[model samples]
Target: MARGEELYITVPSMFRCPISLDVMKSPVSLSTGVTYDRSSIQQWLDSGHDTCPATNQPLLSKDYVPNLTLHRLINTWSHSSAASSSMHPLPPEITSGEIRQLVSGISRRPDAAGVDELEKIVRFASYCEENRRFIANLHDSIEVILRILIRDNERVEFLESAVRLLDLILLENGVRERIQRLIFKSDHEKCFDSFLSILKNGKLSSKVQSTRILELIASTNDSRQRTIGEKIEATLPVLVHLMRTETDKHLMEAILSCLISLSTSRSIKVQLVHLKLVPILSRILSDPETASPTAERAIKTLHLLSTVAEGRTAIAEDSGCAVAVLDKLMKVQRKAKEEGVALLWSMCCGHGDARVRERVGKENGVTKMLVVMQSEGDDRIVRRMCGDLVKVLRGIAMAESSSSYGQGGLGSLETKTTHIKPY
Candidate 1:
């Protein structure tokens, strides 16, 4: 067997860490008689949990001892298993020297040569987890790449390559925080402007990469999310434009995810409404073949948009938008159903527009599905909202019944006394 090459064997249950669920490299036993990977348990303890994760028993002592016997058993078993099989040698790890060479190459040559360097970095990072960790931890690795992006903001090919590399490596530990710190602390405007430039001018793949990066950054925390929303406010129009013009499912999904993350801000929500996001999302949702995740995101964006007056008006004003929202109620996914309920509630109740309520009431099986959703699921808010929606639909039914009676010259008493069941 090659030196230091791990055997790709199925781990025994006892060999797995309870916290991370991975094969433990350094097993330790706690006071509760539960064994865990030392790093996992230490991290859990560092995060301020005083109880054992597996048993939830109060930890009388925070200290742990190395599971020397268990560790020896695992190591012996691994070696024995390796001896019985023809083991394939793992790929060579990418080195900091190689990354430094690429960074220097990109700096010295910023044309096809630079793009070639970035392609190399991207290929290396994309190879495996070890390579990604190596590149991500190497000092100034991400910063150098971001600098290439900023310096060559006008070079489309280089920009695409750099953005692609960033997207690939940003998932590594501390890479996102490193980039976040670099962007916000130094060259904030230039970094974001480069992203904006990509959104506005780069090709479809590059735009997708940029949008994915935005989505990742937005997911870090609320403050950073709001900051990104404000910084990329200009790109909101660009994103909406892309959604309107592009038909690629991946690009569409990425843009929708970024928008949904940024839509938490009221100003951003209003800007999106003004940019006609409602109709765009409505059109996406109206399609039958739209992927479930995409449809759910579209519904969620619309649900957020419905929180504001302008958004509600925009959705209610669109002829097919309200129908699209109702369509999601019948979907099998609970999230879609939840967003659909919240959206319909926001429009019907927030606007108090009788026309919107009447339209929801008129849709087939909506009430039945809403009732089913309430009874089957444990989401109390949805149940309560469903109850309110049912009342509105019933009221709409009664109003229509009363109108029909009056038109037929039936007695006023019948019109006044009639009751309509939603089911």
Candidate 2:
């Protein structure tokens, strides 16, 4: 044994149990629902106590359920911190044979027992990074997990665990592409269809993970995007609804990233336009408190959507759109600002009548364009856009001025137009 001087001098409060006043290596929950260090709780029960030590309530039983999630969190914290690492031993390694045996057992049972075995394997994998890497390398691993996932009659816990496991495996480099190719080669439309079903009907956690997996699959290439777009009739609306309703930032960001990818296709852009995604994007952009990266994606997606007629109409219809685009002129990141400007130009330059141009001018768009042009140290493209926008706005102003003259002072209007070049 080591000397007393080598023992831990202090433990983190969150890592300690109230009963033992020491770091908990194996935390467990008692019948009263109070958690304590397993050893201390067991010792108290072994003394024939009839009440919970923490709650002072009558015990339902002496049994305890392992807090696997909390245990994983503790293990992660212990591995990552220098102070904790000195006092704790890391989890043991899980070998390839063990993983294969677990998979085979799950495949054979397919009952509650199989689910317990699968959950055990998942817990073991979640305990350490090495276990995940080992599982990722196993041949036919994705196939086995997908097989279990596609079973309609399985328990929800089993499906959730299967999705979580699949996500973990896909996070490994090159694994996503392999799975993509595997699904493409096989008759696996049902595999992809299962994702839409989950997104529509699964619990919140499962829906979020399923969306992540769909985004990963959608990002592979144009062909895959088209494939998914054609198969799922309600995919676009579902994503837009989630973006509008989901409050989680990461989930919203994931949905936006997938939207950006899907909107890249002109064919699909029309479908997205029909879904009226521009108003949704405009809402996100106009809110000053929106996250910077999320706003960037919103405007970029708007830029793509603006390539079509319906998209331009939707944007112009939103009263805050011009201001939203103008708000990002110099306020957001460079890419976002560039996209915002492009979207604004698209709204004005292409088939935008005098009424549209006047609406832009009414929003102080001309002054904003001049500010962007005069600001130093910007990309040449942005400066060029500023100049073009100023010219267009001034031309519209001149045309509106001439038209308002109503042929009563055509000569006077011609003289004023000649002097209007500077703005």
Model 1 misses residue 129 by how many Å?
3.2
In model 2, which range of ten residues has the least summed lDDT? 414-423
Residue range 82-157, candidate 2, lDDT tens digits = 5544655445455568778777665565443467666666766654456777878777667677777666666566
Single out the weakest 10-residue window by summed lDDT for candidate 1. 83-92
TM-score of each: 0.68, 0.68
Q: Write the per-residue lDDT of candidate 1 for residues 1-423, one digit (tens) a residue.
A: 687665566667898898657566578999999999775676556434566777867689999999989887766665565632422222334466877776666555544355566767876765444566777777767777777766743577667777877876665689878877776544544667777788888887788789877765665666755554557687788889989998987688778878877776788899999999899988988899876657877888888888888988898888778777787666525666777877887777655777687776665323444554544466677777766776677665555646665534324433532442223
Pairs clashing in candidate 1? none
TM-score result, candidate 2: 0.68
Clashes of each: 0, 0
